[model samples]
Target: MCERTVRFSEINEIKEFVSAACRCKFDIDVVSGRIVIDAKSILGMLSLNWNEELRVVYDEQDPHFENVLQKYMTS
Candidate 1:
């Protein structure tokens, strides 16, 4: 598993990020305090209420996952 902090400050950023990421088969989770949602699902991401740093998690074994993750997350 891998983890990083990410910020999606605008709705358009979230939409574009998700759209670009939808092709890869991986788990994207948005977590704030005690709330967690599927990052791949726009509705699920919006349900978190936005405006918070997100913790992204992905399987470390994925070949292209790291490349895809770098587009949205920061160390």
Candidate 2:
């Protein structure tokens, strides 16, 4: 499994990202004030509080999968 922090300035980009991420399941940690939820559903993504960064967890070594998520990666 690999993990990274990412930031999304636009919500529209999520659909493309989520679709490309189909190969591996992603556990997204959304932190909003006093709440934290492990999100995997697209609908749950909409509930995330937009910020400068969010953590994503994925378990797979597919080069293509990494490539697909590369743009969203931070450092």
Q: Pick the lDDT winner.
A: 1
lDDT tens readout by residue for model 2, 1-75: 667776677777666556566555544444445666454356766677655577766555656656756877778
lDDT of each: 0.68, 0.62
lDDT of 1 by residue, 32-69 (tens): 77887776788887777567677876563344555655
| Residue pairs that clash (backbone atoms under 3 angstroms), model 1 | none
Return the lDDT, model 1, position 61. Answer: 39
- At residue 8, what lDDT does model 2 achieve? 70
Looking at candidate 2, the ten consecutive residues that score lowest on lDDT are 23-32
Q: Lowest-scoring 10 consecutive residues by lDDT in candidate 1? A: 60-69
